[model samples]
Target: MDHDAISIDGGTAADRHARPGAAGAGGANDLLAHFSDPHSVARYAEGPPRFVPGFTDLHRMTRLLLTERAPDDARVLVLGAGGGLELKAFAEAEPHWTFDGVDPAAEMLGLAGRTLGPLAARVRLHQGYIDDAPEGPFDAATCLLTLHFLAPDERRRTAAEIRRRLKPGAPFVAAHSSFPQDDGERALWLSRYAAFAVASGADPDQARTARAAIDTRLNLLSPAHDEAILRDAGFSNVSLFYAAFTWRGWVAYA
Candidate 1:
């Protein structure tokens, strides 16, 4: 669907603040800790529907991004590694590469560790914000479905930090959910998300509250804004690589 072409304006800050209901809130310590139990991996692997198709596209994009590089050991950093789906795939595909998964959610990290097992030895998990993460000069960096959670200023700072840690000409791919301009359309989608959250077993009230909290902190950016931020961070050859509905993806050379 050429998802990268969809550009959203306004609501960047608000979008960061709005939580995608309860499922979104699961990233926080309390909820994520419960969700990340090792035994829960079996249940989660039962093929639940993803909120967007871009979930699978990430592997393709990662391969594309790495295609030009020579077959050498590379250091990769994944910010907000979530459940480690992308990191796992990347690690399997590029055995020569070492990956570090960074996320503030200990539960998510634990789940990823258990899932990766042997491969987990090749991945170092860090719990903290991107800025606070340990020093790095990685060959590449990725932030799948995570950047939207940052405020505008934080986004810029993150871009700069990522760039600082990446080798020259390395790529940084970031994706985040955005809002539509049409108020009715936005409301309708929000309603659908609310229903989806409830169906996923999240508490309705908690879901709504979390969504509101995330909405209050979201800082969505238009394509222009995104490009500008990357450029300001010393990135070149910035390009939007994928998109679907509210999900916008970009790749920038550091």
Candidate 2:
């Protein structure tokens, strides 16, 4: 199956706000609207769920942690857990681990609960941004795809928060869609895609504007920068475990 084309089972608020013309009157409002959209659930329910190859790396990372018996008794935090598909997988794979999923989108959380049903009971769902996440010292944490929505500073702050919430030697995995390292390639693709988006009837200007907005709102940390952020956050051992085109994944020990 085409995993990349397979959408998550639920839609978070961010999906709606990002839709053309549905954006709210202001920046914060637009952000909030997109973050709260409930369509993510519908998308997931429409078909069988499967992890993208990149996400499989996340599962592998978790498995490695389990093999090493990294704080299995500690509470797990899934930042931007979306519809809880990963939570379901983790819960099933390691029932000994309890989970607390935090996402700013209510619709996404609701979908997560519905998708997992009784299994979902093991998770404590929180509706809030990763930056504003409640108290932690979690045994481990995972943030996927969602990081692409923040700017540099926000990404740093969020990483710092994740670090603070982790127990010593705890594992933290953060993934994002990276910009191409080669300046020429990056510029060429952006120029080509910008034209393609416009040719496809999307407002080229709006699309460009939205791209900037996303860059400002999300932190699509480059592989090198991502490692640096983790190391700076006090994570001792950090390395990139996976990459697929723009998407990259990291595994770190706090």
Candidate 3:
């Protein structure tokens, strides 16, 4: 059997090909470490259900994207593509759509490589920032669960780069961490997210630490801020399709 092909039963294609005692093989710690490296697969798995309240946001976003535009044979760009979940889902839906997946984190890219399996070859992986991605006037693009990690300037720069790579009138989907403009609304949302994180199997202390890190480092913007940044980056008709707590998904045209 091809090790690159995922099994319908369980385990990744890489898992099936694993030899005994392979380096970084076996146990939940090793798996967790891999999933939580520079980027995080674990957060994606838990964030929507626990912090955001809607468990099906990603699925709904992808479905809406496909429904709006089939992406058949389209050259799609996946910015900050973690663990390849978006790539796998999109590819499965539109078999002819080719993807350029870019991420700065090595471990995340490795996870994506495994997750993609045989479909790996269909996606050209760039282990760097979006600007470093190969030439592309892509047909469409998706930047999911990213963006808010960057500061205001970097976010603007990245969005500009995305626009530069896409053809005129091309569609782009972006989902990011956000907060309500009102102070009370923001406080309430953050409190709920913290509580939800603890309830969703995260250690309370660790969750608090994570939240602090986000508060200090990540530039979680408001909905208006995001729209302004995108519009300045040359996108038009920025419309929200999904909104759950701090997570918001929008579709824009280049």
Best by TM-score: 3
Off by over 4 Å in 2: 1-32, 44-54, 66-69, 187-219
Q: Each model's TM-score?
A: 0.71, 0.71, 0.78
Stronger candidate by TM-score (1 vs 2): 1
lDDT of each: 0.63, 0.63, 0.69
What's the alpha carbon RMSD for model 2? 8.1
**Tens-digit per-residue lDDT, 14-78, candidate 3:** 54224232211233124333444544653555544555555455756654674465346789888
Quantify how close model 1 is to the true structure by its C-alpha RMSD in Å: 10.0
Q: What's the true lDDT of residue 218 in model 2?
A: 40
Worst 10 residues of 2 by lDDT: 1-10
On lDDT, who's better, 1 or 2? 1
**lDDT per residue, candidate 2, 1-254, as tens digits?**
11122223334455544544222234544555554555635664332212233454566665566336356565888887766777787887776778878776666676777766667657777666664465687888888766656555556667788888888888887776665646576555445444544554556675586456543444344577767777776777787776654557778877
Model 1 agreement with the true structure over 1-254: per-residue lDDT tens digits: 11122111122223322433312233332334433455654455332234444466667686568656524688888887746677778888888888777765555565567666577667777755665455678888888767665655667888898889888888888777655536576555556655666666666885586456434445555556766877898888888877655556778888
